[model samples]
Target: MPQHRNISCHLYIGDTKAMEYNVHNVDNRSTAHIVSEEGQTFSFKIEAGTALMSAARLDLELWADGYKLDCFTFTESVYEVDDAQVRDQVTGAIKIVKLRFAKLNTVDQGPSNADDAEAEQLKRLGTLEIKLWRSESNVSQSTTFPYADCPLQTPIHEKKIKGQSVSHVTSLESKGTVAQQSSWGYITTKIDPYDRPWVAFVFKHASKALLQSEGIVPKDEVKEKGAAVASAKGKKAQSSRAKVNDTKNEESKVEDVKFDDDVAAMSQPQLRQEIMRLRKRPGDSLDQSVVKARRTMKCVRTPDADNLLSTAEKGDKRK
Candidate 1:
């Protein structure tokens, strides 16, 4: 997470903020070093900056692996964004899609053209950045924007790609489970964007091993000896507690929980609301219709994080 102008932002991987390694600040920008994994979903959350939220109009841009995903705006009324917004082109409609981390593969052209201008683009890879800009007016965003059309970098020569380790890049997730935003909105106005952002949050993310190889995060740095010992003791205590309680067992089965009628009444894509309604209940029957609905739902359903999110209360009531 990085903070500037009383505004703080953190990269989220499945609802939890990615663990930041080395964090430092310089002027209007803050950089955090983090780790990410392939196939895992990711997003960003912007905390409301009271003063900035009250007085200024804002715009946000999300960039990952040199590809700018989406641009959103905020006004006095709307000051923050919940999840990262990505457009889904698969559907002919202007629908939003989810993004997940994936291995960034390079088209190797071997070591001869190391000085090529395209190699410069590699510098932006393995980094996730969010820019906060001061806008003159609320903007009506044109469906298509310049950044979205930016071309991906050309293949780097083989020699340059051989030794360099590029970690992961954002890839579209077909089966989306994140629901941070019910819908996205923009303030419609025609205006040029600011030359520079008011503040910037840069997150340099890669695999932990790669980060350590580059010396960005130290390797074998077990300086917290006491904490390590304490952690082990805590784990032992937790294990003892788990023996008498089904809390841990029940919590881990969050993905196994079936849907309810209310959850099946929603609109749009992802899990078909109709299939959700077919879930067995006191009055429900597991007949042909429900069976067919269940088959249709196999493509969209995912582990529902919300079911076990209430930390204070948990466990099945069955005695």
Candidate 2:
């Protein structure tokens, strides 16, 4: 949360408030979710200082990454903070959406249509921001949003996003009636100088790894979190290994043995040998049965496979 002038704002994820790191006097960056106007994945709260009027009329503007969202204005004197549902003034649409990380591509592999956008647009790919202006209630009327649809994090060239540290961008959690309803339309306000907001909160969000890489997060905390994650992943990997081992140790059942044309004259021991012979191969008995990505197999040449097959065939033929 960041507070400037007389207003305080916070970005909340789940039931916990985000961790804030101060940048300057009032400007701070926080670790938070793709913020929401709709109260599902995350919620945002605004608290107005008592220094303001009884019913303070202010235009609330939201921006994620670098794109401006549908802005809104409300006349509410805060008792603690304004946590109530904010909706589209005319359409009564609840602008609930999800923020997602934009997929990135290499320099040459970038989107072909990206040229259509101004370089300025791609500049704000990793910031979550809010601006508030002191406004007159009746003077401010509802207006259309800059974008036609729900604003999402636009993927850009990897080289272009170099300094941003952000790996994720705001994306819709769900594409549904909310985007259609708001059109990102906001309440246009009458301000003396629209360029200067009464208060602005800018948050630059990035992955924990990126934050640690930038030294934004303390190394000790990073190690603690990393250890926790590694522990969980280790348990999962161990379970997977156990399953693979079980499959490998499983006995070759009688039904699994191949049908032989040598009639039923072959001894039971010879039949067992046939199953054993079929289990090995030239590549150290390949175990590459699962997905390639999981890759739980070894590749090596084993002479024992040839020896076992030869011995089994000879015994079967002698019978």
Candidate 3:
């Protein structure tokens, strides 16, 4: 009897769910379909391989989701090994492939306006997942690896014991399984929760470098700028309203000061004496009345004006 290995691949962009493919026995050609963000179904074929062959091949053909990855290629040659190499593992290794894609559009997770900076950021975001199992049956399974879990962008920490170097480490186990889901070991810098870090499958490749070159910064800056702009607008509105209120009140206060001839006839000394007398002889002792009388006398014409008026009256009588 011929030994058969079931091949399956699960693809995810960020933490968002994508598609899965399963094929039984690596003997002939198999087909799978993926629906794009644009609601179009595109087909591709997976060519089977034997143990002696260097690598398995994937023939991808797609023109949907505002992306054109017709000739997208991948290889699975690492599984072909001698019996000596297979003994090093219990369940064997899970093959993971990460690729970088640009200028791709997502259905509802991106900005509505295509030209926005946020939209550009979304386009820069890519998908990455692992090919979980190769079994005897066609049963399919899928799982998402967060950006923090990705080897390409995993955060590094230096532990010190009295300022001595201990060891540099990653979250994955020695056999490539995720050791734990701890925040200390991971750094997820993507603004959108659904977006994943850009990581290429080639072990020598680094995706964090691409992130720096692409000018990906923390989204906190965007929020800070927006709040500053709103605060400035509020201050400007308050100033404008104050100016309008001042202008409106100017006309109504034109006759706020009035002069009385009888008040002007009294000298400064006499006026002060009269104010004091009124304070002393008051039936109702509300200090508000005294303050109002003093303010009215201060607004009247001075002693010079009283003398001029008296002279004018005498001249009129003589004529």
Maximum-lDDT candidate: 1
Task: For candidate 3, list the clashing residue pairs, or say none.
Answer: 13-127
Candidate 3: stretches off by over 4 Å: 1-88, 92-225, 244-255, 258-288, 302-319
Whole-model lDDT, candidate 1?
A: 0.61
Q: Give the higher-lDDT candidate: 1 or 3.
A: 1
Tell me how far the alpha carbon of residue 289 in candidate 1 is from the true structure, in angstroms, after superposition.
99
Candidate 2 shows a clash count of 5
Q: Which stretches in model 2 have alpha-carbon errors above 4 Å? A: 26-40, 78-96, 100-117, 140-148, 152-154, 178-189, 221-319
- In Å, residue 27's CA in model 2 sits off its true spot by 9.0
Tens-place lDDT per residue, model 1, 77-165, is: 33434334344434322334466777776655455664555466566777888887765554553443322432333444545555666
Least accurate 10 contiguous residues by lDDT in model 2 = 289-298
Question: C-alpha displacement of 80 in model 1, angstroms?
Answer: 6.4
lDDT of 3 by residue, 170-270 (tens): 11112334344322221222221222211111001113333334343223567789999999999999999998998878754543332245466677666
lDDT of 2 by residue, 37-74 (tens): 22234446777775257334777767765666646676
What C-alpha root-mean-square deviation, in Å, does candidate 2 show against the real structure? 17.7
* TM-score for each of the candidates: 0.54, 0.52, 0.26
Q: How accurate is candidate 3 locally (lDDT)?
A: 0.33
Q: Score candidate 2 by TM-score against the native.
A: 0.52
